[model samples]
Target: MDLSSSTVVENTNDFRATSIPTTINGLRFYHELDEWQQDNHFIRSGYVKGTNSYKSSFNSLFYIHNETGNIYSHLLPSLVIAGSLVYYLKFQLPLYESHLQVWEWINFLQFGFAATFCLAMSSIFHCIKSHSHSVARFGNQLDYFGIIILITCSLISIMVFAYHREPKFKYGFSCLFLVLGSICTFLTLDPKFSTSVYRPIRSTMFILFGLSGVVPIVSAVNTYGLEVTKRKAGLNWLIWEGVLYISGAVLYAMRVPERFSHVEQDQASLLNNPMVGKFDIWGHSHQIFHVLVVIAAFCHWKGLVQCYHTMHQDMLA
Candidate 1:
């Protein structure tokens, strides 16, 4: 064996060739969709569509980048919400009625699970999508399912608060959202439906899904009158939460900033610029969307708490 003359070559790109990093933890950069190939397929890069294998994605938690931010924004808060739920169960469960307690528990737990599950699915899907095309396809579908769960459960939480005032209006709106969510989940599970060719369709579907909440808002106004429900839910907070969500959704769908940005150009980038290239890894729409989504989740929590307090006082009276 000529150990002194032997050479070893790693199957990674030359680090000096570009600012993009070689395969290593905590320093991964994104690539364009066209850049994905056999040599670089396994590494966890961002700005590319689809998921990798579970083996590859399992290590994603330790990595830091736009993807990490997207995953952790939802992931970390889910943990906090979980801890809070544990406390609520231990300290506050006894305060509600023992008989109708079933409904209360359902309402309370569904909201937490919906929010947490949606986030967990998003992180997991983003992590494991690198597995293969089929895996990536399913991962996207699962993420869509999580979104549906979040929408369905959010409506349920509102129902819990206001259903008693107008049972007909509440149940009607609740069931409508549920059906819409289910259809969206079903449609998204199809691989073709999740593809880039269908990106605009997917985006529009979700935006419409969220906007459908407007119907219930009108129903709510008629049911409890404007003033009463406003006090319970904190109108300003809820409105701000919606503004955040709508803004984020619009950004995600439109593919802004990056769509018109350049890494080297410090100038104001124009629309549909061909420079929508590798520059998006730092401040892309998806990362921003997840951050806004988490904020909206917090807003939803505050509204729920305020509504619960108002209901609890009424119960006491």
Candidate 2:
């Protein structure tokens, strides 16, 4: 068999006129991928190839590959949170003597839905990323939309709970976040800003969007006093949520753990194993980010619960 002839045949796209490889393979290395498929150089191996078809993309979910961790990390959490949210609203809420107000229920449900939606979108993006470039781009846009929704709902819910007694502040913050979220959604979904080259810009935009929460928080503190705001609003849990989210975002942006893949570890060296290619299937920065996002969402949910209890008790009194 002439290898040069085979290479020319594959390049010609004449074998049934497919874009690239028509055969489903075991795994591919970094060098084997097309430009659009290439991501995370530190993950040197374990790629699923020949997934241009939607059938093939969905089938890959059952198979072990580099994205398995990423797909399930958010997928499972999304399922769990969604189920719990439904159960709480349907069964648990009835047990309370004082039912949540209509607005409160709306905010709570919106937050839960947004959190689960974000995770589910992330899972879908990772799962379909091995498909054609266009499909992957669409999935990426869906993921960004979910992030924007989650951020907007999270801030709005927090502000509403914090300013439960102040209608003006609550309504103002809600409007502000909705407008900002719309702007973010536009930027994120834009084809030009969706590329790797604009990653820093995207990250900065999200960071700044999140930081805007500080303004409302400080305003609440000034209006209600620090101790009252902290207790009533569950500020401590919100702080932990912010810390976890920021830490995860920083790690994801910097590409930690896997970024050290270039480091060598000799037998006599302090390290147990060489860092290269070790995190290809698991323990990568993206996986860490997914876990942190889930944990942060949990913290936010718990804080909302705190606020709910306080509000009910205060109303009863």
Candidate 2 Cα errors over 4 Å, as ranges: 1-25, 263-273
Query: What are the models' TM-scores?
Result: 0.78, 0.87
lDDT scores in order: 0.66, 0.80
Residues 82-118 of candidate 2 have per-residue lDDT tens digits of 9999899778877974466788789889999999999
Q: Using alpha carbons, what is the TM-score of model 2? A: 0.87
Candidate 1's C-alpha lDDT?
0.66
lDDT of 1 by residue, 1-317 (tens): 25322211111122211444534443433433433222222222443233344655666667554466667777787788888877876676556544435677778789989988998889877676655766666777889999889978886687667565667876887888889988988888776787656767877888788778767767667867888768655555677778888888888777665555433221223222344334334566777888888889888877776777677767777
Instruction: For residue 8, give model 2's deviation from the true position in Å.
Output: 24
